[model samples]
Target: MTGASAFPRWILPVMSAIAAGVMLALPYNYAGLYPLTWLAFVPLLVAAHGRSAAAHYWLGLLTGLAMYLVATPWMVEFLQRLKDYSLAPALAGAMVFWFLTAQLPAFLMLCWHLCQRFCGHYCLWFFPVLLMVFYGWFPVLFPLQLGESQSAFLPAIQAASLTGVYGVDLMIGISNALVTAGALQAMGWLPGARHTSGVMGGAGVLVLAAWLGYGWWALDHWDRQVSQWPTLSAGLVQSNETPSAAVPAPEPGYSRSWPPEMALSSQLARAGAEVIIWPETRYKGYFEVDQVPGAFQRAVAGLGVPLIFHDAEQQGNGGEFREYNSSLFLGPDGALAGRYRKHRLVAFGETLPLSREFPWLVNWASDYLGDFFANLTPGNDRVTFPVGGVHLVPAICYESAFPGHVARSVGAAPGSPLLVVLSNNGWFGDSRQPWQHASATVLRAVENRVSLVHVMNNGPSTVVSPSGRVLASTPFQERIGLVTDVPYTPAGQVFRSWFTQWPEWFAVVLGLAGLMALLLIRLTRRQA
Candidate 1:
């Protein structure tokens, strides 16, 4: 190939990686720049055009790493905390952090390769479909995806009800492909005329416009169709104290007691809140039939309202001793009503993946590092607590990130259950982690069409409506409380079925069918 005709292979990939990385990092860094999310993958797609599979794969991995580094800088804070321990462990933690970030990119590139082989030129159409299918099933660090960038845009987010987050992701992927194709042609990377590319580019713009228009229509239609339902008066307590097993214990008589903390809840209840919420694992003791903290029990009795709190439990015997991160419901009678263990554990943060086989590593980590994540066991059952006339589904920290986890927790209750998300984000401090974490709850509220009461240990606790609207919220790092009448939509919304049931599987089957049809077509053409 002539110099003019030859692809600037390295340069294109680098450009794609940088552009995609910056675009993704922009939304996370500054919420106002969320519009950048639409354009994030465009450069990457442009670079992928007429490139080798290996090149595309490498470019994708680099973009993912860069994006995570920029977006999740708080991850480094964990390493910084460990820095005083020693340099080697800190470096090891950093390596693990970067590797975790690279996971989705690696999987995405593999999907891209498969699509390319199956669909040929039409693979771009399946890009986002594959993404939705794989990502929904894949265990990701954060459930924050393309759909979340539009969290502020309620109309756009409303589509998440029909297709979950994947719907928005699909639109984004198609838009990027269209833009990439047009750009490639305009830049002479493709054989198509610039005019053809322009039309394609214009079509992509129209698609985006139409999407927004549909969102507007959906929002209007939803508003018209649903009758106003009852609102519950709920109170959320946001304490300044963040609970962590890794932190050093306060000196003797430094007692950070619950009496002072219960003051906020007591005031909220007297102000007419029907329920009160406490942050995750705020009560550090192991809650069991035999042993429950006296102070916590008394606080529950004093409140005279259903109080919700989470704790870390130590269960089993001897070598089988397993830890659980659980949320407990204490009735007005100060008795344990029900409990829900956190279903999805944070991979390395809550539970070590292969610790059963590597007991030595678990022992060492526990002995030296205070068992930060080596023992927490995953929960198997969904426990819903009844308050007044409604059931409350409990979602602990990290569990709120998973749409499926939230969906299952809600279940098919007699009435629309309110999702209560209890979290202690103090570990992250005044970082973007809290903001990013809040974004997921918004998506959950929309997807489940249920009002959510998010009670955080640090801050940013919010009461969200079915339409992804924040009814009330407290700012981050504040020691404050919130009282609001959280609105609930009627049961049997379309989203609960789609998200909880089969849309992802449908996408997968559709892609597989397309792949098979393409293979058959190729065979026929070869024969002819």
Candidate 2:
């Protein structure tokens, strides 16, 4: 192939990215309807072939950037719907999305390429390890993480036991790379493929078969495991509220009573929810400190059930003000029992990043930007609330995407409480944001061998089994106050768990070794 005809170098990455965008719809919104998701990143991985190590690195970077932009516009749309009275902070809000999108993918791409080089054909193994570090375990919005696409195939996701959610992701990256490599090799277009199919082609096919088989078994096991759980009562509430300057902003965005105009605790108890969950910010009037009386205490008192209330707390006012985006747990008796201050506050929504260094910019920017910007401070600890014989982990909003957090919480013993997510999706305004968040919750549940029960202010708040089953979901574009039963995930037979995450450290080491191998190959090739 002449230099002029060298595949144009850029086309494959773009095609792959577009494919990725389409593929991303599968995980939660439309899991398994299309075969496209299974092969989305393959084109880009193929694009990595025949390029120098540096070229491969650049390809991965560009591909990742494209992927993020395509997927996370849902997040941008959701955050943007939070209309402000001014436009500076609003503009800053939009800019923040771009900034976050660019930063994360760039870092992820760096790891992707490093894995490709060091892990070589083992890209699948190393790629996920790096992805978890930069995306899963690390703190970030990650609203559109890739793992959500596998929601259609719970058995496939079953491997999460050993590898964690990162395993599912690793499988995706590896599958993409292998498919791309195989297709190119088959067409006799890849380097050395025309001369020798015995090595590359056989290796690619073998890996593909093994993963496919494993995915099948995982799916089977997942279905069986899911069948064993006793369905418990579950209720996800959608208050259908939004942030608006014209509406007096509710002092805090959420109060126990707002839109839908009902007593949250009363409605929840009447519905007979063994565990009742309110959407994020549903209790913005609640507080962590004394001078401020908790909002839900009175409303929930004597309900004889545990309730999860999302709210915002004011530390003080007038020059001494501090903010916390918090989730409060109230006993059936109407007393605050446990609290989890949101750990991953939205940069433009809840609080601004490094506001002290850029106070003027933030203060001016938030008028139109988003809520409580001064971005609320994150909680320093994780709390598991006691809810009727379960030790439920409280994850406010974005924290549901992190596997390590959920896994640690589930380590409480056999039959721990399911992961509970409380979120306010009104800011996303019926966009794909709620769906995106819903998608990530599955990875967390399946990864940690627990169930996840979520309540969102908008639609898509729902329940998922440890095997990735969506037992129930709220209707899209509607408000709901529901109560249903869900199982307390069982802790028997650790036999088939996929991601145990026991291999994360090893994956990391292997990835680094791959990087070193690439450097050595380049040096030796140059010397020759």
Candidate 3:
């Protein structure tokens, strides 16, 4: 602790927070810096060494705040656009979200400090295990796991196929923890065996090498396997229109006025697209299942191709009426083929947490925030749509972030279904939000060994191969149609990834092992 006081007491923590924040944020903003994430936590870890639990907690919170602010400056704009909040209120709301997210890191630091106190230098081995458990189970508004930062690194990320993102997270955490231990030992802050830094550094290098080797082999194997699967030409349309909830739906029996997306769909259909996909909730109206809208029916018929798009749907009588964010499929004949309601709804944006139980909170919050808050009801079924001899599993917006949910959806459907993620990123406009959102698709594709097509209202719309390769992508805020040949398992051929079979297995094992180790440590100390 004395050696750590070379500078002012606050200087190391502040500097370490800045360094870790920038390193972590850079990968999300610029994909090429993904490798920086391998050591991103080192600065914070090193600075936290020999610190009190309270100090570690504050350092972790500061680092988390810096990371969020640097990575998602667009959040303030999102709040402003989403609720029409003024500058002050929007900034305040953004800070609230930052503070809430900071708790995860704060808890991690506190737990790490306690482990160090009990286990001494052996805490290095437990650090990654603790992180794996936290990242696996800790709930966050947005699940930005450390593994996703390595989404751009296909070789390293291939580990996700076996352990579902937790494996890659564990790998990165181990490297950071080991490096931090080495740095502390070299600085004399940690009294350990001689050449401890060299031993730790060598261990880190070996772990990284094994991780990359496994990734390379898995990528090659999956790539070959996907190549032999049946292929279909699919078209993704990014209309780039920011649809407003305030915009009223056209009256029933209104003229068949086609949106710009219809023209794009027509062009894609003419170019031999078998199925055309659209972003989430682009059609701004209630789509009654029985009473099909003439305009929508005609538009789909005009294309002469299967169409998949998002729309709001209402069901039940007055008192029991509920609305849903849904994905609907239209057959080539322009008839309702299949519909899947969104299962996951965004908090505050789509639904208030306890509004249903309290009911009055909705109205009070709406009046306070100057925004209407009609919560969208969540769907219970994992519905899949059949398209051109292949089934399509749909995930709307935030649902794509959950690996287990997406995997279960794919597993629920017979045969190997293609994952079609429909998202609307217009609220966050021209920022790292879209890119970060899109990065999840890469891991989803790899984790389930399924081809995924992520179509967004604003851009970075992408198509990813089962091997985690970006087959095609569109720039941000562009009105473009990307036509790509998507590969999927042929009908009657079911496929399941190892990770899908046993999701979060790595995290579970690590948690159990950590518990057993702690028990053994306590028993050994008592005996001593």
Candidate 4:
């Protein structure tokens, strides 16, 4: 076992490769239903045993490749969408998503490899810091840590209260380490073969106990919370409508001359909905304000309820006709009460950056970016409004992926509130895009301790609790579903307030610091 490091070069590398494949396919597929995402790292970690830094770096690259390739197939869509770019450039652009997202796993392996020689056998405990290093960062584009896989697992999730989502990720990493340790024991890599069996059994018991304890808490909380929950009557409408990505629209059905969407808004209102919600882009299609009567606004004002619509318009006259994606909140009286122009705009969908200036990038859209051509101006404010007697944050789209963005917005409020993510998932085309997007929302909901209602124009619009439990969701297409009343979490979840991805950083530093100290000690030994 000690000389195994000197074995044929292909042996460990092949094993490492096989492990990466299993790690990627097993955890993501249905049969591996368990959230064994962290388990994937076990073989990669094992491969690092008594290795050179260069060897460790290859291991890091391999880990990153497996994770980035499997976790995000959606990047292909971005590449395919850019018809003008060469296959290589488009692919490169798409791969930036991979480079940006996989820094944690890459670093995790590096940290583990650096410290293993010093830890002797204690390297198992060092992984808790790996979790911290990976989870910590600012403006995390796709902050999908290993813990997210266990969103369906309740036991390990109990740690969410202390460290938010990152804590659950930490515990799962620990569990995965235990599993890898057991595997190593079976291989006779460590001494005390007789005691290995007992130790492994104990670890199994600890994992099971932690899992069961958390499950009990979640079940108990659900049962008790439901009875005390205040019910509110609300109606949701998915208009399958598009305003401009800038032009505003009158109410869907009533634009003076019997618009195409006549029955939609009125039906939602008639359904006893105190607050009738509409999907994003309810006003995004080829319609101008002049097309509707000036009194059309007055007519909806009479509906006596709030209706949310996405507004878009191209700037006119001498200007380049800029476009805006916005959420329009009309008061019960139908007059425009408030608005949150979408803060985050899609790279190509909203406005292509610098494409207008460079021209070589090819401005593909029908609209202009700025006065001549620029990116759409993002909204500066996070608009939280009251409707149906609940305080809420209305995120238009894409903002859900950025948990810290929601936290920053919701943080301004005294406590957590119900959340409404008005979206047009219709664009994704029945692919796993909706699932990926919706899955990330759960992280945001749990992180903020808020009930989120994802109302979509096309598919996978769901209502999720602070725990990321799905209450109700529509299938693909022009569908309707009631969330009944989403439960508003009573304030105080650590993540909602804790802005820094500090836990991830601490892990990195700890691992790095530990490795450094051991190196210094080794140097002193050589001198002595």
Candidate 5:
């Protein structure tokens, strides 16, 4: 194996691609085998050990293409919902999603190649740092990083609050790199093969042990601390309702109304629910304080409990009305208590990307393609709603995927220790997307150390604790409401407090320092 002729070149790249595919399938797909994520990249690492820069570049792109292609078939579900679905549109959307999300893998492998070439064997441990830096900046929806897979491993993921999801991502990267380095040495791919194997193998085991050990201690400590905190009885409502095929264009004050289920509200109240939640757009009205219907107001007034729902409204900017995806909160008095407008709009679904820069293209696309979506207004500030004793960070629809946005919302109201996600997932149909979307709430809960309440239209309403544990959830696609006492504890504040002041600077510095070291080493070699 020491000689180039001893091993086939294709072995490394092929194994690398297969490992990446398996890793994505296990954690992201319905397999639910998240533990496999830790070892998923080992095969790739082994393949990459003796590779040249050009070889690593192609391998990285290939691995990224495989990872995203397997992990996110759910993207095609939306395109398929088009008027009489065709393979062309679905394939087109898949290509866009793959191109955007695949950058992280390509960036990661580039880091590995650079480290191996300039920084030598010791740089294996630095791969995680570089990966973290790149991931911190990479823009994608609901970042499904390597570390988020270990969300089920409570102790291991407890570090998320401190570094957001990047900390856990770093740990996974470090462990994988260590294992890869050791394996390469054993395969006679390194300079001091025998000695390096002992060092790397022992280091990898120690790192894994420490990671698990830290998790156990954190969980045990958090459990004892949380036992003293008071819990809240929250009710989540899900009605199997899909959006109408003919969604009317946004006009000035176009009001639509669908009364919420009063029987379910009464049942939840009778069961000691102080707060009741309805799924996004369950009530189809452009509600305003002065324009709310008398019957709707009277109905909410009679409920005797605070209610949370979503609606759209017209905002006047020089007499032009812009619509927003707003989270509406109604008090017991049937009056608007608070509102949080959705900030993160879905790509090409609500608002077109880069439409601000290329305004003419917006009109061009609309004219040619028949206006697929209305240009909805994105919110500027984080808004919190208070119902009963809980202050809620209302993450509407796709906002749950952006951990930093959710964290900033929670950070805005330090007193507010809860996050509520209202989503209308009917657009995605019966695909695995509902479950995949719900997974983001788990990471959000851990990142902010808050209780997360997810209410969705057309199923899978979930209640997650500060520990990232799912306490209660409605079955997928079920038309039923769920009531659960979501835990209230301050375990995640450790990361929250740290992140609020110093965001990703630590990761930035680590990545920059590694790059600088690599550049210096390359220069020294050139000078020699």
Candidate 6:
């Protein structure tokens, strides 16, 4: 067996980049390919084992670009649909997104390079900790994580209940690192690699056994627990309508036609729905807090059930006017129960980056970017609406992608809370974005141990159980109402996750360990 010298200098890095990308993308594109993720990084790690710092950076960037481009080519179509961009501009925007996303992998590879330089072959063991630390903290446009590829693998993701997604990432990372070590040793890349790989492989097997054992127990436990809990009969309306390119200005005192979602809600109520949810911005008109229009109020009161729906809200007057993308809750009496303004605005789509702190940037960008710049103000609080004996915590679109944000909101709610995510995937058209968006909620449900109802425009509206199982879902690009009984902990019964209480604890511990490793390396050099 020969080392890097046996192959052309460029061969390993290029092949490894494409191999890792395809492996990572497959699980996301097809649920059954999840097993590939355990070995996904093996190619990249082996390729990077003896690379220089500069080479590592380029390899990392190439790998990341390949992964996202393959896994989320939908982003380009989304930009064209959302912004009405021509092909060239849409592709340019997607490239910017992909490049920004590549930084996380670039940094990860640079850290691995440093570890190898300092700690010799033993640095392979440190790879998992490094992965947990970096992936947990790295800022990216989309939070499509390595662990999320296992969303369909129920048992593998059970650890998210205790340690969040990072735990699953660490497990997968360990497998890849161990496999990479063995491959390197077999290829004669490093001295003493065989012994290190053998010992780690044994420990890795034991760790995996414990992980799956816990997962098996946890799945059964959650299944039984959910069945015993009280249930809320909820209806989710998927209107399957995209917002018109141009909304005509309202005529004074003229009533708008009943939207398709409203008609769907009426039918759902007739079917004995206790509450009905509408996807984000389903109502095209603006709403003022506590000032429901007469026709709208009458239509809602007619349903005879609580209704949760998304709307645009405006506050203040004249120069101080602020617009918000908000979720509104209406009681059975048609009175506004609560309004949750979206706290997490989509970057660039909902609001321009740095626009709040630097208002001048908004003005400057608006001059150049025109209609691409949105001015929706972010809300300051997470609101929980009480319906019947249960509380519904609302997460609008992009907010559901954030585990900590969703967990904190669920934890803040009194009694058993069901997370209701309202989204308008219509902007992304019939693309992988809808499926990828839906997959994220699976992790959020497990991380918080809360049942979640994700209702989206343009389909794939789903109800996820505490066990991360998709209990019910609508077909993509469908117009229908998905009605289901969502289980929740009864009032006075508490269901809180340790990860919810301290979501960042695992990442913090890993970060500290990384710092200590660097210190040890420094001390070793001093002693020598």
Clash list (residue pairs), candidate 6 = none
| TM-score of candidate 5 relative to the true fold | 0.88
Segments in model 2 whose C-alpha atoms lie over 4 Å from true places: 1-29, 46-70, 85-143, 187-208, 222-231, 245-268, 288-298, 316-322, 356-371, 412-415, 490-510, 516-528
lDDT of 6 by residue, 198-316 (tens): 88788988898899899999999999989898889999999887653344333344335366777788899998899999998535563642333555678888888988988888889
Candidate 6 global lDDT:
0.83
Expressed as tens digits, the lDDT of each residue in 425-526 for candidate 3 is 987866789999888778999998889999999888999998889988998888899788999986666678888888867778878988799768767866
Model 4 worst lDDT window (10 residues) = 494-503
* Candidate 1 backbone clash number: 0
Q: Model 6, stretches more than 4 Å misplaced?
A: 1-8, 248-257, 288-292, 367-372
Residues 1-528 of candidate 4 have per-residue lDDT tens digits of: 568766887577647844663574344323235455656667776676567777776677666666667666556554443333446765776687777655556666677776566545556656655655565542345455555555565455544533555555566667667777777777777565436446645775586577558756864675466446655455666655432223334554455334433346666566666666667743534235563434435545666657665656445645555556677666777666777767776665555667657865544454322222235667787677667456667787787765556666776554446677877655434455666666556666666555677777766677777656777777766655443566665434323424223323334455577567666756765677
The per-model lDDT (C-alpha) reads: 0.70, 0.62, 0.82, 0.59, 0.71, 0.83
* Best first by lDDT, ranked: 6, 3, 5, 1, 2, 4
TM-score of 1: 0.87
Best by TM-score: 6
lDDT at position 232, candidate 3: 81
* Worst 10 contiguous positions by lDDT, candidate 5: 249-258
- lDDT (10s digit) by residue, model 2, range 362-401: 7676665534344567777767887655667788877676
Model 3 segments beyond 4 Å from truth? 1-7, 193-206, 243-245, 248-257, 286-292, 368-372
Q: How should the candidates be ordered by TM-score, best one leading?
A: 6, 3, 5, 1, 2, 4
Residue 343 of model 1 has an lDDT of 84
Error of 5 at 282 (Å): 7.9
